[model samples]
Target: MINQSVNEGKTAAIISHFWIIGLIIAFIMNMSKKNYFSSFYIRQMIGLNALQFLNGWIVYKFLGGTAGWIVGVLLFVLWIISLFGAIKSEEKLVPVVGEQFQNWFKNF
Candidate 1:
């Protein structure tokens, strides 16, 4: 069986969710091997970032700092779990949006 663990170059996937810099790193890493999770995870991270970006308008825009803090913390936790799973070579999805990401970006 193919080792499911993210390999040497695959580390990019786990780090992609940290911030935009991580996304750039992932992009560079994936430039040579497009089929790797490094690429797919980067795409997923971008999607997640976009979602969070839009979240500010939906909840934080009116609820203010308190709601933003709650939502931000929740997103951070999910990001950590997904990053850890990816690093450990597991295909576990990130709760509600995990499966959707995989399906939406299947072509990647």
Candidate 2:
């Protein structure tokens, strides 16, 4: 039973990294099961999604040049790394603001 719960949590964790929709689904899944693993990934994904949104606005609207593209690439790389971590069922904090994200979204 413990192993089954862990597997479920890992599955939810991995799914949470897909995108905003996946994040919501994972959030709901975790709510039902209350899995710490899924919660960790959910918080990270929330932070990542918020960052991506802000980055998009700043880059496209304010920057609108090579700088915007560069930021987009960097965000993509971060997303990939976070997704990989989730897939591996590891609580690897993302670079830079990962720890901050965990603290900020602790209630989630």
Candidate 3:
């Protein structure tokens, strides 16, 4: 059963890593299936998207080029880590902010 859920959700989990559009698709897929594996990844993607907006847009707006670039790279690294986890069927969170994401998006 666990293996099946992981397999079923793996695609959605991977899809969730492709930024906004992928997140949307993964979310819709998971909505019907309601599997824990997909939900875990979807929630993480949503949180990453939020942070990307907050740090990318807002920070870039205020702090100018360099800070925004650095943060963007960091977020990209985090995204890579998250994507790898999804790919491996692992629930590893993306460092510092991962826990916060899980808590905030618990309902998803």
Candidate 4:
């Protein structure tokens, strides 16, 4: 049972840890078969990354380095938690933002 989920989307799941690489792998995998966690995690990570980038840029431009560092740390923690959940086959989301990801990325 566990092995089946791993075998079904293990590549995508593992790839997702690599940031962009995992995302691409998930996209490709989705083309053929659907792995629930892999697809959700991929989209979640992409959205998170985009938000982080935008926040960092805006903060750096306006608030400077200190604010950016704070936001970056928070995002890092979220990423780690999300990765852990996906690896464990748990559908847990990263605190507040995770549930939204699940809902938003349901189609994939």
Candidate 5:
């Protein structure tokens, strides 16, 4: 079952990690398939993009250069980790808010 999901959804899952455009593309690709694997990464991308927006608005605006940089790096690392897990056909959460993302975006 796991291997089958990876086979069917790998392309969409990888594309979903590339930010908004990729998220849209992956979503379209998964529309017919309704792939669990693709949906999982799509939810992750949604949350990550929200974090990106917050980083831009709140972190960069109020936190100053050093703190903003730190948070930015951390978010990037989380993205990389999640992307790598997708590549490896793994379904691990995206660190802190991953579970929340899954719960909140369950309808997707």
Candidate 6:
């Protein structure tokens, strides 16, 4: 049973990184089961998605140029790292803001 939950959690974690919709689905899925691993990744992905949205908005509204592209690439890299960590079933942090994200979203 524990192994099954872990497997489900891992699957949820991986799915959560797919995109905004995936994150929402995974969040709903985790709410019922409350798997720690899934919740952790869900929070991380939520933070990433929020950052991406904010960056896009700022770049479109103000910093319209190569700066936006650069930030987009950096965010993509961070997303990839988080996705790989989920694939490996590891609780690796997402980089600079990862720990803070975990702390902030602990209730999830």
Task: Evaluate all candidate structures by whole-model CA lDDT and list the values in order.
Answer: 0.73, 0.85, 0.93, 0.74, 0.91, 0.88
Error of 2 at 22 (Å): 0.5
Error at 40, model 3, angstroms: 0.3
Model 1 pairs in collision:
5-89
What candidate 1 gets wrong by more than 4 Å, as runs, is: none
Query: lDDT tens string, model 3, 1-108?
Result: 999989999999999999899999999998876999999999899999998999967889999889999999999999999999998999989899999999999999
Worst 10 residues of 3 by lDDT: 24-33
Root-mean-square deviation of each candidate, in angstroms? 2.3, 1.8, 0.8, 2.2, 1.0, 1.7
Better of 2 and 3 by TM-score: 3
Model 1 TM-score on a 0 to 1 scale: 0.79
Model 2, residue pairs in steric clash: none
TM-score for all models, in order of appearance: 0.79, 0.89, 0.96, 0.81, 0.94, 0.91
Model 5 residue runs over 4 Å out of place are: none
Can you write out model 1's per-residue Cα lDDT over 17-100, one digit (the tens) per residue? 778888787777777766465766776787677668866777688888788889888888778877877777766577888778
Ten consecutive residues with minimal summed lDDT in candidate 1? Answer: 1-10
Per-residue alpha-carbon lDDT of candidate 2 for residues 21-78, written as tens digits (9 for 90 to 100): 8998899888866998889889998998898888888877887768878887888888
Task: Output the TM-score of candidate 6.
Answer: 0.91
How would you encode candidate 6's per-residue C-alpha lDDT over 1-108 as one tens digit per residue? 766666779988999998988998898888877998899899899889988998889985698868888888999999999999988878879999999999888888
Residues 12-96, model 5: lDDT tens digits: 9999999899999999999987999999999998999999889988998998878888988999999999999899999979998
**Candidate 2, poorest ten consecutive residues by summed lDDT:** 1-10
Better of 1 and 6 by lDDT: 6
Model 3: lDDT equals 0.93
In model 1, the Cα lDDT at residue 87 comes to 74
Best by TM-score: 3
The candidate with the higher TM-score, 2 or 5, is 5
Clashes of 5: 0
